[model samples]
Structure formats: structure tokens, C-alpha cells
Target: MTATDVLFIDDDAAIRQAIQQTLQLEELTTETFDNAASALKILRPDFQGVVLCDFHMPGINGLDLLKAVQQIDESIPVIILTGQGDIGTAVTAMQLGAYDFIEKPFNQDELIELLKHALEKRHLALENRVLKAQLRIFARPGPRLLGGESPKMKRVLSMLENLVDTSADILLSGETGAGKDAIARYIHETSERSQHNFVAINCGAVPENLIESELFGHEAGAFTGAEKKRIGKFEHANKGTIFLDELESMPLALQVRLLRVLEERKVERLGSNVSIGLDVRIIAATKSDLKSKSERGEFREDLYYRLNVIQIDIPPLRERREDIHLLFHHFALIAAARYGRESIPLNKQQIGLLLQHDWPGNVRELRNRAERYVLMGPVALDEIQSAASVDTPTPQSLSDMVDAFERSMIQNALQMCQGSIKDTMEYLGLARKTLYDKMKKHGLDKAQFKEDADHDGL
Candidate 1:
């Protein structure tokens, strides 16, 4: 639990010191400010504390300060300290959002009790904010999967929806950065165990020596530096789901123990004989083919079969070419909202470059580029073009080659006409509908290329 501080503001130096000393004896963290102005300067919207202010002061009295604090964060409780016969002023303070009021020469016990209640209210408000944020991440409809109209993506979404209610173990195979973990999370969030913990661990990240201890925690004194008993990921995820990313990296020795736990539905902590029953659903992900590894004797065939009850293979970004534009726009919108920036529109040339690129890093790479576009704006175009040019491969099919040539010609005409639709259509010698259709198909936005009307052209 985080300790909440008390901010005390009073013009009188003696009153401020006395209150500070009293709070110190009660083991409460307190900050004393001489005036309301100084106190207001330090208060923030996310402040986890309560405020105490004198009813009358030289500048910005307690009532004004109460309104200001409420504007910053209504959750922070502000208590007013009034002198004797100031009952009318105290009533006004309450109307202006003061939490409570205490008369001068107030009893120490009463003051402490009021403060304790205020602190508890502040703590609950902060906790509710955090939980609401978490719920928003999983409860939103559509775009949670970050998928598109591509057939491959549609199949993935269908599989996820079908498995949402099942307790079957799942195996997700995909190229690195293809959003395997995201699929795992989507499954958990939409499943019956949505209310339980969704524990995730990257098998390749933990060191070989400590991986066992991390997965099946240890009793106190199980090993050096093991000062206390720890709950393992499996136990933490009991009655919910556990996602093991990079599962191919787990050692063969651990695989044997994992298989036993899966079969028996229980785990034995290191240095402990007692077996703890578990109701954890395992979702394992890997970039490598476990079947091939099993054939090569690198992986246990039995464990592979156990985990492969249901398999979901996510397509790489290059294979889902049509989804690139939709995904880029999606990530751009998210970045814009997060960083308080406008989503920059992509010009014909930039859109062409995005579609032609091989995206070896897949969806993750596209998301990063979108974030950079939001942060750096037009400057990111040069970087995107450079990366795409380096990775763009030769067209292997006639249709692909024709599409590429058509996109290039359209981009050239749009640029030459300074983004005038009529001029571009005449320049390309194409019908108006044909030009518009191609522009939409190629994800080109002519507005991005438009020069200021005051100036004819660059």
C-alpha cells in the first residue's frame, strides 16, 4: 500500500508548524505551505493525498483554494480549518466542494479520525481509476484484435471467438512480431476466465539457471538469495490463463516437469513435496515449428502433442497486403490519441512505399512506423521510404508487376498536377471513376500532395 501525504496550508507559521508536528506524531507524511497559492502550485490531478487549509488567509483564502483543488482533481479531499464563530463561512466552504470542516482548537482525536477517512477515500478513488483503465483495454468492441478484411485474419478471428469458452490448451505459431501475444491476450480477455489473472512470461528472456525457479517458484531458502516464499506464474494464473511466449526456448529438462504438471493438473514447488492443484489454461506461442524440432529430437514429441490441442497460425504482414493500410491507420489513430498529436495523412508515394515493403518485422514494425509518423510527422516519410526501398523485392507475378506499375503512374500524375483531381485525370488519360477507384485501392490520399492555393505549384 502506498502512503498518502497530507498537504496543510495556513498563513500563520505557528499554526502550520503545530499541525505538521501533530501529523508527524501520528506517523502521517505531511507538507506545510504558508499560503494557498504555493499549495495550489504543487497539487496535481493524480495527487494521492488530502488537503487542509485555513478558512481565512492573506491571499487566496481556503474557499478559493478548495474550488481550485476541485478543478485539479475532485477526488482529493480538502478539509477546511475555521476559527470560532465562522460556522457560516464553513457552510460556504462545504458548498464549494470542501470535504469537511474543523473549528480552530479542534480535538486531536477528531482531526486524526477525519484525516484517516479522507485518506481511505483518496486511495479507493485512485484504485478505481486504475481498474477502469484496465477494463477499457479489454472491453472495447472491434479493433481489439487489430485485424482487417483479409481472409487470413478473418480465419484467425473466427478461431479465437470459437475458443473463447473452451478450456483447451492452445498453440500459436507465427513469425516474430506477428502479434501472437496479442492473440493470446484476446483469447483470455474474451474467455470465461476474463476476471482472473492473465499471466504472461517470455521463455527465452529468463536465464537458463533461473527459469525453473521463475515458473515453479521456490520455498524460502530453496536456493541462494531466496529469502522468501514466492508464487510462480502457474499459481498466479490459477483459474485463468498463462501465456508462454517463445516456448521453443524452454529447456528440455523443464519440458518434462511441465508435461507432468499438465497431465496431473498440479505443480510441485522447488524444495517442496506438496503438490498444489491448478486450473490454469496454457497458451503457448513460438516462432519455430515444434513438429520439425520434435522430428529432429530437439523437442519432446509427447509434450508437443499435449500443447497442440488447438493451433492458431497468424499470417505475416506481407501475406496480408490489403490489411497494411488499415493497420497503419489504426495504429496512427492510437498514437495520435496517446501523444496528443494529429494523425498525419500519407501521400501517394508514401502509401505505395508502405504496400511494397516486405515488413520483415511484421505488424510490430508497422505500429512503430505509425507512432513515428505521429511524433515526427512528415519527417518520417524519408525514413519509411528508405526502409521500404531496401526491403522491396522484385514482383514474381504479372498481376503484381502491373499493380506496381499502375500505382507508380498514378502517383506520378497526382504529383505532377499538385493533387488536382481534374488535372490528374487528364494527365493520366483515365476516366474520373477509374482514377478515384485506383486511388482508393492503392491507399493514396491526394489531399496530402495539395499545395497551398495561394501558390500555384512548387
Candidate 2:
């Protein structure tokens, strides 16, 4: 859906034209209409704008339209333009959730400022909505998915969710620190076989001379160093998952045996006649293109195809810039708790540094930076900017800084109070309705904080 700064609705054609001209002069994008019906027809729950409606419209009066807008999205700011005689109705509209109201013959500057604030609020609501959705996906036990809002990460989220139950083998393609190992573990943890063993091995890290024996457990006396019979990873992970990192680095000779094990769903111990039946799901990760390597004879083409049943490609941090802030924020929070420090949300300058530097190490690098920031504070960000050859970070508006700071404070208070609204209100010295309004404005759900408290053994 297209986004506008304002959805202007007034039954008076002259007033609509005048108000539209005034808003456009301030460079605000607006869509003006003569009646509430036409305006409501175009309104959407995801509309990234505010509604400015006249309280005395012919059909669907301002209060009724406020109700309709609330039905669509209560988070959307709705401003009422009321006549002096309609002050009582304006108050009623406020009671019904109008963002604010302006009396007739309002000062143009005041109106512009009001609209600007509303627009800023709308932007935050949309962004917070997205963050909340992603937060839920990573809220489960063990490693969180820590996915992004970018298109590529959204696709990854969909694939992971869809494959949580299926028994198909998975191949993860991504650069180092792009979280291939974490993704592999997430798949296994979320799958039906979570109760079984999850064996992870780095194909390249194992010495080639003993790699074969390491994979297909050797019987005693099978090798010069083999003193006792051993079970290999495949057997060890029976009815569970085996994640092989650096799959392309596995020796060609071993690839042949790996292919056989994958095909027959069985493994043979070295120098043993018994063939153990298997039920293992292989999740292989590679930093390079396995298909290209297979064609070049560096990797076995057959084994590549077998593991390629489903390949999830994780985009680098630079590629999904929109997700950088959220990822950094989450990591920072976790770091603060670990370090027993008061979590300090990133200011405009620090956020600029984070966005400006292209993360060569991807999520791992960002996570490290978060931990460092928690331990060292803003100086770490300055150090990062000095060491990296990146553009100066363009700062956010005052509104953004205020909203982020306010939200951070409210969230921390809620956590401290274990989501008790009364305690939080008292701690913040806010009236009950005022605190609730702020919470709703920032998309802070008390129940989530309560869950967090319970999980943390508070």
C-alpha cells in the first residue's frame, strides 16, 4: 500500500482545499477528501499516516469515524477539527480515542506541528509492530532465530517455519558468522526429533587421516590408534540431527561414503560386518557454492544433490540493512543483562556508526560489538567509527531519539516491576492512564515482560 503523511477528511470543499494547500506547502504528503465515507473507504490497518477529520461531517461524523478508524487500527492517530461550538463533542471524541483536536481558525503553525508529531508517532508504531512480530519468533528456548525484517530474512523465517515438522534434509548456504550453525540448531530444536541427540561436526576441522574413522566409528584394531569400538556421528544421532559444517571441505574420498550412508540410511563400522540401520537427518552448511564445487570435481555432485533437498540462503548483514538496528538492540539487551549493566539504548551517533560500517563479520561481528558496548559504553562506538572506513552516521530526528529513549525506559521499568502496571506506574511516576497510553504507544505488552520475568526466575 502507498504511504501518505496525512489522510485529510472534511465535508467543506473550501476547507479541504485550503488545508491541503497548507500541508503541501510544508512538504507533507497528503490525500484530501470532502467526506468521511470516501476517506474511510481508502483507510487501511497498515496505513502509515494519520487521519484529520472534521467533527461535523455530513455522514459518519468525526466520533463515528474515530470508532471506525479504531476498529481498523487504534494505533492510527485521528485528529478532530472542531468548531468552537463543538468543544463538548471534541472532548467526547478525545474520550473515544481521538489523538487530539483543534478548534476552528487554528493557527497554521500549530496545526503543522501537530501533524508532524502524529506522523512521527505513526512511523514508530509501524516499526515497533514489525519488531514485536520478529521478537516472538525468537522468544523460544535455546538459540533464538534472531531473524530480520528484510525480505531475504523474511523468506528464511518462512522456510524455517514450514520445515519445522518435515523430515527433509537441509543445506544452509551463507558466509561465516552469517549464522548457518545457529540456523541448523534452530531447525533441529524446533523439529519433532528435538528429544534425540543433535551432533555437530566441522568437516574441515577434523584431520583428513582420521576423518573417515571419526565419521564411521572404527572397531577395535580397525586402525593403528583404534583401541576400542566407537560409534560414529551418524549412529550417535539416530532419530535426530547431524549438522556437518563446511560440507564442501569434506574430502572427496569421504564424500563417497557419506553419499552411501545418506542413500541407504545405514552405516557400516570400520572392519565390521554389521550394518546399523539409521534414522538421521543431515543438515549441512557451506560458505561456498557446493554445486559449483561439485561441477569442478572438488565436491561430489551426487552428495551435493542429496543434501540440497532444501537450501536456506542467509543474506549478509550489509545486504539487509533495515534489520541491523533491531539485531544490534537485541544483542545489546542480552549483553547488558549478562554484564549486569544498565542497558543503554544506542543514541543517534552510535546507531549511525552501526549502520555506516559494513559488517564484514555479519551478525557475529554485530553481536561482539554489542557486548563490547555494554562493557565499555559509547566509547566502543567511537572506536568502531575510528577503525572502520565508513561514512559518518546520519542521525535520526529528535522525535526518534525521544521515542526510543522513552520506550527503553518504559520497557526496563516493566521488567523491573515484573509487568505489574501499578508498580511500573509508581516507579515512573505516571498516572495509570498515562502509563497505559505510553505502553500502547510503544507496543509494550505487559504479558511478555511478565513471561520474561518468570523465565528469568524473578
Candidate 3:
């Protein structure tokens, strides 16, 4: 355990001096209080150390001092050092929240060991409190996952509803910012484990060196700074769901450990021999193509297969154009509430501008734009055109300008339909063959546009 600030309370100066000298080797800061009244005056709630008080003091006994300390903050562990061997009184002290009791002439080794154990317990207790507080922030509904009148969306919601009963693993895949975490939370909230806990850990966020201990825990003395045996996310989410966002970023070595837990229903903490059972349902999400990664040897094939049991691919916001208006309205409403303003309108020009741009960052980008819209009002069309012109190729020749204009017109139409060739052709009043020729001349991949349209089930 970490060396902590310790306090010793006893009227016997010799005993106090002995304890102070013994603990000095451990580099623990110690304060000696000759009486309970003096100890009370110095005791503060922020003290992380344990208190060692003699059972019999001049005025208040050890049990009474423990009670007083607990009333201020029950978290601090109190150790009672008594000369008598009374089990009944010891039981009473235990009932009163005394951490542990030691008979007089306590061995330095034994005393140090008990103090280390008490410190570990205190550390875990404090950590749990902080984790619970952070969880409360995510307890409320997150950013909106709006839109679903299309068959694809309806089916997605139906699948989510079905998942509310079973403890089956769920896999979500799509472009970045597609709101995969939102769907994961929806399933967790509607599931039987809602009352337990829903722990979300981003595999891509943490450093590779620490990921294993973060997932499966670590034993005391396992490594440097492993002052105490720590409970990892798996044990923390014992009876609940564990959402692993960006699961593809997990290292192969860690993936092997994870696969074993998923298969054997148990996990062993790092540097520990014993295997502890787990009852957590895993929900893994990835923006990258896991199948591709598996084939490329970047991700484990068996792990991919395990996680892909119940897959739900969320379409990007650009593909799900029908949901654009709904998402915009939702985001606008949130912005209005946050800013304490009335409803702001997105006029026809604003709507047309939104329909023309391709959202590379998906729903997250769209929500950001909507919030920007609420704050900045409608953006100038000429400014957008000027921005577009800087990136797009400009031709000096009249013939080339005409060709560029034609390509730009077709591209705008394609973006409006989120790259649906059929819709683009219909909007442009052009034949499929002509659209094909124009796309070929512009060096465009017609298939890529068609893929997004098909992915959205357009």
C-alpha cells in the first residue's frame, strides 16, 4: 500500500515513540497524540491515513474515538490497539466500525501488514465513489439518435428492441460519428441489466501498456504503482453491460485475453493465479471494417467472429438524408434550450445548402453544424460558393468551363441524394448511360456513390 500520513494516540510516550520509530522506516508521516481530545482537535476529514488509538485512554476510550471519527467521515479506517484479550468487546468495537484490533506489543511486521491492508481498502472505497459520480454524468440521455421512417431504420429499432431481453453480444459498425454509442446505450437502458451498471470504455483512448490492467484488473505488487489490488472494468460491470467502443484498436495480446473471458466466462487479474468469474455482456463498436482488419491480420479473426454475433451497422448521416431534417430540428431544439432562446428557422436556402454538402464526419458533424446554425444564423451562399471554388478545379478555356459546370451540376445532384445514381439521374433529367459517361469523364467512382445509397437501403 502507499505510505500514508498516520496518527498514533496513546498516553504512554514509550509506545508512541516506538510506533513512530517503526513506521519511520516505511517513510510514512506520523503524528503522536497523547490524548483523545488532542487527536480530535487535529482530525480532519481529508486525512487518508488510518488512526491507531489505545483502547483505554484517560477520558474517551478507543471505541468512543472510532465512533467520533466515523461521525465526521465513516470512510477513514480506525485501528484499536488494546492490551486486554476480550473477544466480546472486540466484537462490539467491530460493530462500531473499528477496522481491526491488535493486542499489546504488536509485532512491527504484523502491524505494518494490517496497516497496508487497511490503506488498500480505503483507496478502493475512494476510487469507487469517484467512478460512480462520473457514471451519473452519462446516466442522462446523450445526444440524439434521431430519424427512422425508412425500412432500414425501422428494422434497426426492431433489432434493438429484440436485444433488450437477451444477454447476447452486440456489434455496431459504421463511419466515424455515426452515433454507435447511442444505440449501445438504448439497448442497455431497455435491457434487464439496466438497474445494474453500464460501463463504457474506449479501446482506442487508453495507452496500450495499461489497457490489460484496465480491463482485467491487477494484483497488489503486480507492477510499480500497483499499490493495491485494483478491480478492473470487467468486475466493475459484473452483472451489467461492458461497451467497448473502437474495439478494433485493441492489441492482439489483449484481444487474446478478452476472447478467453468471453469464452470461459472468467478473468484472472494481472499477476494473479486465480480466475474469477464474470457475468458481463459485451457490446463492441468499431468505425473501421472489422472483417477487412481481420483479413489483413490487424485484428484477430476469432475475436472478430465472437464480437460479430449480433451486428447492427448504422448508416452515416449523409446517407440517411431523410433523417437530416429530423436531426436538425432535434439539435436546434437542444441549442435553443442551452442558449435560452426561441426556435430558430432553417429557411429554404439553408436547407438546400445542407442537402448539397457531404458530411464526412456523419451525425456528429451534422449536429455541430446545426448548433452552429442556431448560433450564427443562415450562412451566406456566396461565401460557400467561394469556399467551394478554392478547392474545385477551375478551367481557363470556355469548353473546359462548360465541362466543369456540367460535372459540378451532376455532383450537386448526387450529393443531394447522398450519392444515389438513380436519384441523381432522375433529378438531372439525364439517361443512365449519359450519367455514366459524365462520371467516367470526371474520373468519379460511380460504384462508391451507389454503395452509400445501397448501404442506406435507399
lDDT for each of the candidates? 0.80, 0.79, 0.74
| Segments of candidate 2 deviating more than 4 angstroms | 1-143, 388-458
lDDT of 1: 0.80
TM-score to true structure, per model: 0.60, 0.58, 0.54
lDDT tens string, model 1, 1-458? Answer: 32336899888899888889988776566898888998888898777779988888888988888889989999899999998888898998888778999998899889988997887687657645653553467355322455455567878887887898999999999999888888888888888899999889999999999989889989999989999998899989999999999999999999999999889999988879999999989999999999999999898999999998899999998776666765776677567766788886676567777777778898888888888999998787677677665664744576864575576567656644546577788877899899999999977667544421111100
| RMSD of each candidate relative to the true structure | 18.9, 13.2, 27.6
Pairs clashing within candidate 2: none
> Best candidate per TM-score, number?
1
The TM-score between candidate 3 and the true structure equals 0.54
lDDT of candidate model 2 versus the reference: 0.79
- Residue-wise C-alpha lDDT for candidate 3, range 223-323, written one tens digit per residue: 99899999999989999999999999999989998999999989999889999988888999999999999999999999999888889988776555555
Per candidate, the number of residue pairs that clash is 0, 0, 0
Which ten-residue region of model 3 has the weakest summed lDDT?
449-458
Give the poorly placed runs of model 1, Cα more than 4 Å off: 1-144, 392-398, 401-458
